[model samples]
Target: MTDERTYWFDTMQRIASPVLHSLANETLHSDLPTETPPLKPSALLEAFGRTICGLGPWLGATDIPENEKAVQAEFLDLYYRGLANGMRPESQDYMPIVGDHQPLVDMAFLADGILRGGDRMIDDMPEDVQDDFLYALQLTAQIKPYESNWVLFSVLVEIMRWKLDDPAYSQQKIDTLLQKMMQWYRGDGIYGDGQNVHVDYYNSYVIHPLLVDAVTYYSDAYTRSIRDVVYQRAARYAATLERVISPEGTFPVLGRSITYRFGAFHALAQAAWQHNLPENVAPSQVRAALTAVIQRTITATDMFDANGWLNIGFYGNQPTMGEGYINHGSVYLCNTVFLPLGLPVSDPFWADPAKDWTAKAIYGNAPVPRDEPVNY
Candidate 1:
């Protein structure tokens, strides 16, 4: 039987391959079944964007067992083929940049996926393919995101532009997005998505992750200081997330995007992957906590369709949990929970023996230190 961590990465591949295979081969438009969708092409691309982002770190890793190398080798081939098809204006796989709305907003995630895998995927593309990929990504500029965390969408695309050495990249836009995130900071390790704080997971799912990633592209003293604050807050929030997991592996199915399931823990998983956990939160416990969550959520009945496509639901097919904006692809955001799987097996996060997470430590016989308030 595969261990939970291996299962997590495999699950990521299983969910991604069907969409990517057809897209790469130019059959996605014809072969993909458009179900429960408000928009077909956009939803399919969403599935691609969300899936590839999680695979980014894993695909970039140089160390993995032989089996993972095989899986990586296969998918990397599919990704390259699909990438070329997606970029060509005349190709059947050409993805439409419909409007300056959600279509382009989703493109930010596509940009993010490329950024994450750039060291591995983008760098290896043949010269012409590389130019095609960069041009396709830069085309996301046509859309204008809303005032909230959506601003990060545009920023992500622009940052990728800067990364590709796109001559038209704007430094002013990057600085503006950074300032906007600072304004949205609500203190106590949380951020209001945009103008108002909706009770949801977008902060962990998108905002801070992109914030930390963006600063690295153009590092300066001011950006470095802001990045530090972002890491500290994200660390604090990650600790809070660990306690939310129940001993039985269940959690409150709260707020919007409950269908996103364990993706709510993206920040916690990312913090652990980055080794940014607060001092009190041991890496072992986080691994344990996330493993339990991954097992519980992925095992949920009806999570995948008969053909292995991801359905929009939390546990089973609880479609009501999804918002009007959610389509089948939106749920793929759950892949972010597997971020820690990108770490090499020898890292303490994976190598350390299993330990009781915060909940289990406090409730069970394990000794845990007293909790301290995080002061920012």
Candidate 2:
């Protein structure tokens, strides 16, 4: 790799390594409002599992200690227990909760056990555990009738492949979801989070890549036609987002939980990894811009305690304003910063430290003239 490329990889490694290292030490308290109000441990488990899975690559054998394995094992064991405790589906406001969120929890664990982290835990699952997971998927198919968030629904399709691989898991529902989700597309790689037209980076960072990944996982059956269209547009959108960083290396910081500002880089990272980055897009530039944003938002004194509990609020120590859903362990969702784990070391993009994006072009690159106001 050239010195220029090496710079970007080094910078990304720096920005991500600390967050992954912090995971083992982060305090996970369950008595907090995040767990008390809704009183559902599965959501917390899902959030925690996703965080761990997102950060796992960085935490591989060499980075994390062998001693920490027991801790992580216990953490996962508790989450699995929660899934076992309430395997049935529920509904809310006439919408199927299975389609809305519960399935997401089921899929999160399923992915945690099989697809995302590998199938190491597959054989270890008790017979009853395997049966409950199947029952959960059956419930997932039943709830597909009234759901609208195509992203969450798409997860079930991937989980089906990973869990059952059965041709009987409802291809019709998957097709319906793809059709509905495509309706949210406004071109240039953006998809509305759900109904309506509120546009933001979350769609770019979370929704698009997740859908694309789901598309890729089922490539054996679904033709490449659908995946190609979404990937091309997503890469283009990532290219446009490259211009969002200021010459000073700052983003607009325009959405909810500015704490999640760093999480926005996950989409760009995936684009680079997939080798689908736009022609005009430079991985080095995305790295430099993203590194700058992390430095600005994730202050050592504010974002985490000495013990590693991610402090609430965007800039300071204020857990009071966090959602009723943010518990001690939930804060580690911030580890979504390391979503670049999917990228292999052999990838040219990760071979170097970050380079500059703000040098040649001034401040007018990827300007969003107007941002949609999100209801807090």
Candidate 3:
């Protein structure tokens, strides 16, 4: 098999090996051994299940094989359990621990449900549940003065677009959300997740990637005026994220899920896919850099534990300071790390190793430069 095929297969196998095991024996909706743990609502347990379930079909899309039917079967079992127990069809139950996170939950369900689950999901959600879900989606329609973390908003937009089947379906909402998001960006490609520009991984993991996907989706449906603005902002974010990577190929593991480590590559790959990445922003270089990152933090034994949970933290076994409500499985959403799988294996960006600063200097190539930030 080609390297591309190898990557696709290896990634799927890695993800499914553990996930399939979890499905076979694990039960959902059990109370935490400790008090409510971070990331509230019993719904999240279900959401995690749905998210992994979504991954199976996506893996199958790449031809993982029918023998792997266990993946989807497990997804279906969890999804049904979620619908039957955790979710109430008539109520909107998406409250967050901090900042408004309902949209994230909504998008997660909608994206996983429609894109991956299809008829299975629709059937599982009774009519009342569907109506309630539509109501929950409408709740995300507001534009506010404060720039809350905009990643969830843009992600909601993608899910809405998928749900609505309109290329320009949620234009007004997208426009308003974008305008609000723009206020948080301090220029030179960096954006504060919300107000006051305290920096972290949001730029690489959420901000830049969401912008690229939302813009590309909207542009496909509407005029250049709408699309071009987002593209320009995305280009700048991509450039800045490139500079954040150290000469050693590591970016600072600051922010929420330091456990998520290389998960930020989703943003990098999205930005690259939206356009030809700048010479300074190397895709293969990023792939190699993040490979080092994933290797450093995750262990082969992470899949097996006394409690049957995966355990690896950004700062080793101990949990760090900023990880608010996240738990073990919540961290695995970091498996979103493989989201770049959406990019076809044949994409040229994946074909060659990117030249790092050392390579650039040695080979007489243009240096990858970082622009200083503008303090707001």
Candidate 4:
């Protein structure tokens, strides 16, 4: 495997192992560290759900090297057991799917994991665990999401139900939520988060990735046009993300949720993973750029506690960087950078020779194409 791929896989395992191991053993509640004791319950769900959301594609892929596949198989076992334990009321690690507004967000992450995990992860589920999974999703169905990007949460949950062929899935609700999201699109490949644009990474963190997945999954005659438009916008946003990465791989620490670390590039990673990168951006450049960001961010001192749980910080254990809504589990969203790991070793994303990203080329005085804004 290439060094970049190896780095990504090793990093993913490092971040995920502690959570999955503890949960699978039904000890997550006791093991997970939380900045706020009262928020531990929500944070546990955040860690598990968000980890799987990012790992899903890699976990589902069947074309990996034998060594990697063996490792993935081990994680798959832990993942299945973790799911069973997390959903079972009798299990010590049971993470409530129904509750306050927080579960609405993490449940969507869990649902996105299921979508990305695809049939390999879903089809092998134990019958009892499958029932519990469906039931837990049904519970989350009642959650009323916020007027903003939270709308996409509801859409993803419904999409998961649709993927499972559950009768509870509502096409009407999915269509309505999706339509609401489109209305919030502020143009130039950015969405307004709701009715107003926020100067944050929510576009990459939540809006574009989930929106693209929703439309792609629910594709039909009605959604075909919508899918094209959404992906076009996503590609544009992705290109912008690529350009912003500095020669050192650091991006502007802009807006809220900065503590999610490298997850700020979810759209760009997803574009490369899905072979949807804009015409001007090369897959190899994205690989190099993201690898640099991962190295810079994850290798920082104090990024993780003594026990391997991620601390609430952007660079290190800088608690001041966290918003009131941020917690230990919330930062696990950084795993989204591993999305491209879903690609097979032979895919251009992994196979192509590494190249300097746009920023690096410009900074080095290497000839590169002029940057332009997407007119759409």
Candidate 5:
């Protein structure tokens, strides 16, 4: 872990520790900069989702190295305590319904956090807390997701429910949502944000990951077939994303949620995690591409506040980059970039020697292949 690689993991810990350490201990809202946001409760849920989902990969891992485990163990332990309190009827981080749709939006990521947070997030928790956690998730059932990407939030919550084996939700609910996403599919690995096409990364950030994960909970051939198609779509999408990285690691700052930062790569990183990257994209290449992006985004900027909670900007304290809905929690969506950490120390994504990313290879006079689109 020398030079670039060294800074990556070290910076990951450094940048990530403050948010996880603060939130897991129930002080994130206080310690974090909620400088603006007319809607605090909804903003709080946004913070919860962005932060927790970003950490999903590392927290969900089953084989964390002992040395690193010791490093994260304290914050990890406190996070469970924090999660338990978040569900309590009264707490600083208490969950709240935001309009008819917003709670479902944030709860999806809360469900995502529990799903990806691994045993420490759920199974290893004290029994009563686990029961309370399940009950807390159940309360989300009251909220309805608006059409569009919001649909996957409901699917995610139900998948968590199914994982709990609680059977609390009707299978039809999951089926209907999956069907809607498929309806939104625009072919060649792209799905419209919802009923209308939007120019953004929602397909990568939300749709693809949820599609890949939710489709797995069912055993039916139809579901399995959809998963296969999704993996294919994801592979192509990941490849496209790889090429989008500039030689210097920057990407287009288009569309909403630009404050989500590297979280824009959630689908791509999840593809790398599942070893499902397209055949044309080498695993090491994707790794290098993403590492560069992470370095460019997370390590190279004054992205954090004085206390280390993330600020609402892509690079620095540019509050104007955040939308009206944006808050401290919403920006933590950047954590999704860490999904590759779920790969084992031995996995090729981590183990492979670094290679030139597409942009670098081309600019450095190295041979690069022409990009192509797949019918899938």
Candidate 6:
């Protein structure tokens, strides 16, 4: 494997092993550190679901190297066992999917994982486990999401339902939520978190990724135009994400969920994974940029605890960086940076020669293309 790919896979295993291993062994509740007891239940779901979301594409790919595939097989076993344990009421690590508002968010991440993982996430599981998994996901219908980005969460869950042919899936709900999202579009590849604009990474963190994935799955005459516009905006926003990465791999760190680290590039990573990057953004440049960010962020001294669970911080263990809603499990969203790992090693994204990203080129006085805003 190339160094960047190796580093990404190794780091992913490092971040995910503890959560999946403990849950698979039914020891997650006891093993995971819950500095904030009230958030513990939701936090557990956050870790598992978000980890799967980031790992889904990689998990589903069939053309990976043999060594990587072996490791993937191991993790797949743990994922199935973890799912069984997390949904079983009798198990100590059982995660509640039907309570409070937070599960609405994480369940969407779980659903996104299933969607990205494709058939591998469901088709390979035991029938009983599959039944339990779908049942747990269906329970999210009881929790009403807020009108903001949370709307996309519900949309994603429904999309997953549609993909699985679950009877509970509602096309009406998906269409309705998607229409609401269109109203929030503030032009220039940006969407207000809801009705109002907020300067944050939620666009990358939640809105764009969810909308793009949702419309991609449920495409029809009703969604065809929406898909065209969403993908156009997504490509534009992805270009913006690429430009923001500094030569040192640091970004502006503007936003509420700053503690999610490299997840700020979810749109960029997803673009590469889907081969949807704008014509101006070379896949090799994106690979270099992302590899730099991953190194800078994960190398922080206290990014993880003694036991390997991620700590809350933009840089290190800066608890002050966390919002009231942030918790240990929440930081696992950083795994989204690994989305391109879903592509095969032979794909140009992995095999191409490295090149400087926009920022790096500008900082080094190298000739670069003119920057322009997307008029869409």
Please report, as a residue range, the 10-residue window in candidate 4 with the lowest summed lDDT: 216-225
What are the TM-scores, per candidate, against the unseen true structure?
0.93, 0.68, 0.67, 0.97, 0.92, 0.97
lDDT of 6: 0.88
lDDT of each: 0.77, 0.51, 0.49, 0.88, 0.75, 0.88
Tens-digit lDDT track for model 4 on 304-331?
9999889888898988999988888889
On the 0 to 100 scale, the lDDT of residue 211 in model 5 is: 84
What number of clashing residue pairs does each candidate have, in the order they appear? 2, 11, 2, 0, 4, 0
lDDT for position 349 in model 5: 75
RMSD of each: 2.1, 7.6, 6.0, 1.2, 2.1, 1.3
Give the alpha carbon lDDT tens digit for every residue of 1-376 in model 5: 1244455556667656765666567776676678753347766566666666766667767776665676556656756766666666567766666344667877788777666666666667777776776686677776777788888888888777777777676578888888898999887788888878788888777988888877754455467768888888888888888888988889999898888888899888888887888877887888888878887786546787777777878887788988877777777777777777767777877777888888889999998888866776
Error of 6 at 88 (Å): 1.2
Indicate the residue-level lDDT of 69 in model 5: 71
Comparison by TM-score, 1 against 2, better one: 1
lDDT of 6 by residue, 1-376 (tens): 3988998889889988998899899998888886666446887788899999899999988988776988899888898899889888899988887647898899899889878888888877787877777787688866788989999998888877677679878888888888998999888899998899888899999988988888877776667878888999999999999999999998997979999999999989999999999998999999999999999987788988998888889998998989988888899999899999999989989999999999999999999988787877
**How would you encode candidate 3's per-residue C-alpha lDDT over 329-360 as one tens digit per residue?**
45454554554443444554455654453333
TM-score of 6: 0.97
Question: Best to worst by TM-score, what's the order?
Answer: 4, 6, 1, 5, 2, 3
Candidate ranking under lDDT, highest first, comes to 4, 6, 1, 5, 2, 3
The C-alpha local distance difference test score for the whole of candidate 3 amounts to: 0.49
lDDT of candidate 2 over 1-376, digit per residue (tens) = 3433334334434433333333223322232224245535444343444454454333332223343356445544543444344342331111122525454543543353244343434445566756666665655555433333445444544455446554566555555566677777765567776666554456654566566666765554553557877787678666666667666656665554344445556567567656777665566566566656666665546665654445565555667645554444444444454544445444555556555664325544543223232211
